[model samples]
Structures are given as structure tokens and as C-alpha cells.
Target: MDSAKAEGFAESLVDLINKGALAVMISIGHQTGLFDRMAELKKFTSQSLADYSGLNERYVREWLKAMAAGKIIEWSSEPAEFYFPSEHAAFLTRKHGSDNMALYTQYIQVLASVEQSILSCFYQGGGVPYSAYERFHEVMAEDSRQTILAPLLDQILPLIPDLTQKLATGIEVMDIGCGRGKSMIKLAENFPNSRFMGIDLCAEPLESAREEVRRKNLTNIQFKQADLTAFRPAGKFELITAFDAVHDQARPDLVLRTVYESLNDEGHFLMQDIDGSEHLEKNLEHPFSPLLYTISTMHCMSVSLAQGGLGLGTLWGVEMANRMLREAGFTQIRENRLPHDPMNCYFIVRK
Candidate 1:
């Protein structure tokens, strides 16, 4: 309403649109591997880059200029040379501690689900649709293991001495919703004494998981098609994990109880999931949070509701989770403070 306020509002609006466009450009650049290649030699002319990467010259030329204009790179307009700016090092190149390319590129699936965001699951409820159930199961698992699980294990496993003890001699573990078992392979290798069994609903990702296991000669890992909802753990589990999967189960509280009963006494149940809808405004600050919310709404919630049209799977908040875990009768309900940033919370309930 005031002049200053109006000026600030105008700037904010411009920044909003510019940011959206910038994200698209950055994602395209990463998908095109422009930054990675550029970081290799540090500098190259547009023509040379097009030839090197075998991309269309005109498209590459325009893209490079846009990167310069977006401040992602600096352009020598005289000779048309493009040099990657420092930001690329901190994010686009692996030199940056986080790399963050996976954060951007892997999240493209959210965009794929954008069309269905308006199809409110509230009107329909129970029954995960046939197609969505399959897709959601696969995508969510792969995304979770890639983006969060390894990082989680790297952080949480050390906290419990049992894991380190096993790593000394090696041990075996089970991963729920293990999808293609990419993360499990690494976990198996990390703790040589550890073998991992990954269980999922579909045979497709499970097959891939099996292939990866065989490829690595990881005798410690295996894949199975099973539902955590009713499929009891085959044996005592040393380290059990369901990254963002268990919370969406038809009966989540029961699933938590199942996880509780399945674990060896004192073994940890690590459930990495986002239940921060209570903090919608705050969630925007964390990109993955928003992306997860979008997926939960479109694919996750939508699919869960598809079967009988039950909207029971619509994103549940922390309070409900706490209530459910309490009802399920878990002994301890400590939040894994450092497992995930605030946006993605983990319920480290001790069995």
C-alpha cells in the first residue's frame, strides 16, 4: 500500500519469476552436463564445447549465453568464450560438498506429477490405483535411497555400536522398500560382515536390485517382493529402515508396530520421512521438502487413495505420527536430530 512497500513488492515479484526461470536453466545445464564438462578444462569456446559434447551448436550457444546472463557463468562477449563462475564449483561441480545436482535433476519427477496436483485426493479415498501404486513405489524408493538413505546410514549407523561391531566382522541387514537396492549394495560393501535383504512390492525394481547385488558379488544382499504391512520380517533385523515409505502405508500405526516387533531388542528403527506439513511456510526454504510435499500430494497420496479411493494416505503430520507410535507402544520416540534437516524429520523409535 505504501510507496516503499510497493517498491519492495515489485522487486519480490521479479525475483519470484526470475528464480523459477533460473531453476529451469540450471536443471537443463546440469542435465546437459555443461557444468561438469566446463569444470574439467575450466574454459572453452561455444563452438569447441558443441563439438566436444556433440550437442547442437546453436542450442549450446544460446544456452551458454543464458547461463552468463543468469550469472551462472561469465561470458567474454568479444571472442564468445564462456567461463564457469564460482557458483558452479560450489553446486554444479562435485567439488561442492553437496554437489546438489541430484537435488535438482532427480526432482524432475515432481514436475511430471504437476498435472495431477489439482486432482484433490480429499474427494476420493482408500485404494491405491494400479498404475500409480506401481510407479510411486518404484520412484519413491529410488529417490529416497539415492537422496537420503546413504547419507542417513553414514550418519546414524555410527551412533549405535552394534553396527560398528558388525563392520569389524561384517553383518547382514534388511531394507524395506529397497526399490532397486542401489543403497543396499553400498551398505553391504561398507560393512563387509553385513548382508542386506531388500523387500519391495514389485518385481521390476526388485530385479534391478538383484542384478546390482549379483554384479557387485554382494553375497550379503538379496531382494524380495513383500509388503511391510503384513509381511513379517523373516528374521531378527539388526538395522531396519523405511525411508519415507512406512508413513504412507494404509495403516501406518500398524506398520510401525510391525517394525517395532521385527527388530532385535535395542536395534534401531530408522524411518526417514517428511511430516512437516504443520510448517508449510517454513517448508519452502527446503527444496526437497516442497518437492516431497508435491509428490506426497500427487503420486504418493493419489496412488494410495486410488485403490478404494481412500484418502487416508494424504500426508500425515508429526502429531499424528507421535500419537500412532505411542499407540503402537514403542518404548522410545526420539527424533534423530541430525539425520535430516528440520524439513525431513526421522522418527528413531527404539524397539
Candidate 2:
């Protein structure tokens, strides 16, 4: 037996197990505002922190110990005080907004909810359906608000020069798979002269989006619950966007073709998708490649397979993305990546 290889594997497995437990705890800390509260205090006892955060003292103490053991927080023995390092807080706290690492930790629990279905799919040929993921839209909404919304205005849009100005002067904009229509809402608010339409298959998110439109008195934006398969826009749009929406489609090829046809001559199609390599070997080098593949197996790929669709899965890298864009009739395709967002790659395509 190769004893050295076995020992290395054993240590790696132990580290993986530790990280799994820490992920759940971090999710708890994020959801309960414990991390946010801790960032406000310099040093605090379990009781004090629990009081400040309005959580149970006993539970808070246990959680603090776990965080300390995970090397996420500072621990002291003399007074049993815990300190949330400012440096660490930058990644942990919601104050960093979209830049927070704790944001994606919520996926650990969401993915766990469908563990049995995913396991069943492993043995069987079929896959877990979208209906099985009840909290997916909510989780996705939170994820989008944090990661996409803030940057959509200042960072993402500016990539297409004069795009914002064009919107301000009134242009047709369509966002496919616009969960809760938050992205469209943000754009509509910023560019009131532009008309916007957001389409998605899920009714729940569309309903929520309508509520937001009413609440915000947004006149330029609208949402519709429509399947992308047979989607035929009334007219060619000047701008079309799909944020983290292309990878999991039942027929992404068809959707992309439709998007190509829907754009006017010289119109722009900005698509945001996972930044990954098509090959497993290349993907192995990425830090979050494991998580990306796990998410695809559990949710993205499975849901598409459930619909009897093309399960392209995540890690459909830039090469495949560019190829697909070309096949869909986009001759001028440019890829861009944001420094702050490591998870996604932007493809700017023109008809």
C-alpha cells in the first residue's frame, strides 16, 4: 500500500470534515446576525454578545467556541471573551455587502435540504426536481441582492460603454430568469426613461417582484411568469441580460438562440455565468470548484435534468460559453470579469 498517499488523503478528509461543520456554523452566524453584531463589539463575553444580538446565551457560547476552534474568531481563557477580528469581519459581516464570503455559506444548508434526492439520483438515472428545492428562490434572491445588485449599477453596466446613457434616453431592456426582478428594478430606478421586462418560469419570484414594483412605484419595469422555451418577445430589444441564468436551463441552446433572435441589430446581450473550465483538470485548480460542482449536482444540473432538459451543469467554462455564443449567432463576443466577483464571468455579445 502507498502509506504516504493514504496518510495525505486521511488528513485531507479530516480537514474537509472540519470545514463542513464550520460551514454550517458560519451559516447560522450569518443568518442570525451574530456575525454582524460581533463586528460592532470590540470584545465580548458569550452572555454579553447573546444579549446584544438578542440570541440565547448558552447557544451563543457554544457557537463562539466552534468559531474559535474554526479559527474564525479570537478566543481568550481568562475571562471567556471572544473577539471578532476586523480583518476577518470584513469577509464575515454583511457590512461588506456583496463582498462578504459568508453570503455563499448559506448554500451549504440549502444544498443539504435536497441531500436525499441527490443521493437517489446517484443510484438512479433521473434527477431531483426544482419543486424539491422550496427555498431556492429565496436563497437566490438574497444572493443576487448582495452580489449582483450593488455592482449592476456602477461596475457591470459600465462595461458596455454608453449603455447606461442609452438606458437613460429610453431603450428596450429584457432580463431573462430575473429572480424577484431585483436587477431590473435597480436598473429601472436608475434609468427611468428606459422600459424593462423581466421574465422567469417561477411564479413565486414574479409575484414578489410585482409587490416590489408596486411598493417602489416603479413605472419602467414589469415582470412575467413565462417559460423561456417558447419565449417570443413582441419586438427586438435594444438590450438583453441574463444574470447567472444560462447554465441550468432545460434547453440553454434554444434559449440562447431565442436571445440572439430577440436582440435588435447592434443590440447588446450581457450574460453573467459561472467562471469555470470545461475540463475537470482545469477546474481542480479553482478554489471554489468543488462547491460549484456540488451546487450543479444538487440543484442546477438536477433541476434541468428533471425538466428533461440539457443538463450542461456548472463549470461550463469560457471555452464552451464562447462556442455556444458563436453557435447562437453572436459573432462579436467579448468576455469580462469583475475584480470583486470571482464567481461569475460576463459575456458581452453583439448581434
What lDDT does the true structure give each of the candidates? 0.65, 0.90
- Summed over model 1, clashes come to 17
lDDT per residue for candidate 1 within 111-193, as digits (tens), equals 45444433544554333343443244454554455466546566756556566676557554777767677667777877777
Task: Give model 1 RMSD, 1 decimal.
Answer: 3.8
Which candidate ranks first by TM-score, i.e. highest? 2
On residues 40-114, what C-alpha lDDT tens digit does candidate 2 reach at each position?
A: 996999999999999999999999999999999998999868999999999988888766888678888888999
TM-score of each: 0.81, 0.97
The clash number for model 2 is: 0
